[model samples]
Target: MALMTKLKHVDLLADGSLRYRRRIPLVAQEAVGKKVFQQRLQSKEGADLIKEYAEIESLYEQMVAQRLVRARKEALWGNTPRETFKAAKVSSESVWEGVRGLDRDDPEDRHLVAASLKDEGVKKLILNPNKTEPKPTLKDALKLYRKERVKDDAAMETRITRVWSEVEEAIGDLPLDELKRENARKVRDHMISVEKYGGGNRSAATVKRMLNVVKAVVSFGLVEFDLGDKTNPFIGLKVDDQGDREDTKRLPLPDDLTERLRASLRGDLAHIMTILDETGARVGEIVGLEGADLFLDHETPYIHIRPNTTRRLKTDSSNRMVPLTDAAQKSFKAALKEAETGGPIWPQYSRPRGSDSASAALMKNLRKLTKDRKFTIHSLRHRFKDRCRDVGMPKNIQDQLLGHSSVDVGERVYGSPEAKLRLAAQWIEKLT
Candidate 1:
């Protein structure tokens, strides 16, 4: 029951008669004491009544302060009904009996849920009503992972291969559910550590890329096989590339150095690098380029790159004709002369059985050729971008040249073969 108190005071009338008044406390329990106190004050025992009333008010104030403290404590720490009484140590078990007695619509259900989580020794199990571990295998997860990649709008097959390779090396045998954060971190650390021994210190960015793939696979598992709510373990893992080995860094090659490298290179590698340099085409694009795609008509020769048709261009603007420079034109002429009927312009760039091993071989050769210029063959593409920037090419044209039109063009119009060829000629002049 609620408690209250009363105040007693006396007043003198104009006719010289004494009268009394009482103030009542707010609660029903205190109202009883207050009523009796007021009765005594009305009987003219004013001083005694006043003293009684003051005591009652003091008691009421104490009860109010204590009740407020209890309510505040209950609101903060009390989540479940059991926890509420447990914290408050309230003897009135009935207070928490009726759901309606407490605010049933209070938005503290999350806390109540957390408080009621099952403690399963070492591993606290929440919502494990079935009392069994979710049996999602890593192999199954990986299968789904690969299938999804195949259907990806962007077919990241190479990236998928790389991710699978690491998973195989580190925790391939483990189940998906068993591949927890600590194990993942250990594998990543091991990869970083042994990198120098295997070849050289691998870039953290490269390691992170591999980890991110694994992380993505885990996320897929969550959706494919409903794992209970847990924070994404890979979200906050730091992968710093700032201090990675100089040779491992993937920055653009200098324009002057690239030209020198092209001139110095002997056979197909040099020709391929030059093509990448002149056209700003990606390694994938260059590998897939063909003599049929190149047309030597209409005042200037142009290449018609189309996805799933002439060649897989990967973008609409990647189909652009980069008007061949003298160097590029001569290089292609020689390449065409050297090739079989169905062979590509730079046939060496084609997947020559086990593309991974071939790619690694190419990087090693590039490393030696650049005389520790310290970058992969892929950096030639980066050099192209840097060269474009250095020559003040518009961002749109630059993006087009790099085959990056994966979305709607913002303000900048997509270029045609003629426009691109013209742009390429200007860009080549800047390089020279």
Candidate 2:
């Protein structure tokens, strides 16, 4: 009981170790999820006890600071006073937890404890549980934005997350209101000139997309956090043209390269590439294919492209039945046989937010096949379009086969799926 006699909130167990125990504040009960916070001091000696207590108390203070930041963010997002109080209470408990036990004999320890309390108070004031004027940091903005968007648009979420990661790397967590035009320019320059995005200077298309993602997130944060009146630094920001790299346009794979890819790729990757080459279906579409989506036995053997729980088509025009060529039919049969075990055609790649993962794996395999980075798995679709055009397929028919919105008003508004399918099947037969 020597430790207990010296320190308040410190209990001496039968084995002689000291323990600190305190009840969690009533307001923070929900957030902290505990009636009491307890930590064993793991020391019997007075000096060791004091040192360990200070360390633990410092950690507890840090925890409270974090909770307070969370509470303040909730308030900014329009959480009620009662809800914010829970977080405030947790923070208050953290400060008290740090200063609860005092060694009156040790003046240095007491001074250290007082200084820590002052530091915590300063942090709490800065966080300001009640006020919501100054917007949250770009870091917090990104965090909240991702939470809201990930459910609806995982691809966009991924892109935003990636862009923000680069931004964060270039400049540490900056306040949203403090994100000046200069900061925006720095980020753009960093991405295009300094950062090796995709192993080289970011192409013009990549720079534009990254800037767009940053701008969209900033815009979203302004609206979501009710800071719309604040100037958006990302708006009207320009990235110097890094020349016309044609980054987004996947080049058509030549016949020689196509043959090599077919021979080289194996397993699900091979099947995915084959489907892409023959059907011109997107990698996401093919990877997300289901047994039910395949209509092989029907009059027109085709793969139905539709949004499912796991994957979403890029646009409304993306939803259609692509008539299978003889080669595509063979690939689908092999994929179907594998899918007999149940779930999607490529179950391993069939994740709700997994298009990037699928693309990355395919790219790694592709690097082995060819040195040209432009000739990706997506190039199969471009190659398909080239082949369709070379064989004298009409523009409307080509658009239907590739799931592109037809430019012609009549074809776009009046074209039926069945009619398009017949035209597509005929053109596809020519290629086969």
The lDDT values for all models are 0.54, 0.69
Residue pairs whose backbone atoms clash in candidate 1? 5-25, 138-176
Tens-digit lDDT track for model 1 on 227-317? 6474456666777667765545668877566666665454555566677677777666655666667665546665545553223544565
Task: Evaluate model 1: give its lDDT.
Answer: 0.54
Give the root-mean-square deviation of each candidate in angstroms: 34.4, 18.0
Q: Which has the greatest lDDT?
A: 2
Model 2, 201-255: lDDT tens digits are 4466678888887887788877777788889988887755535446434588889
User: Residue 86: error of model 1 in Å?
Assistant: 49
Clashes of each: 2, 0
Clashing pairs in 2: none
- Model 1 off-target regions past 4 Å? 1-134, 148-158, 193-200, 230-232, 244-260, 304-319, 340-343, 352-362, 369-373, 385-395, 404-411, 414-417
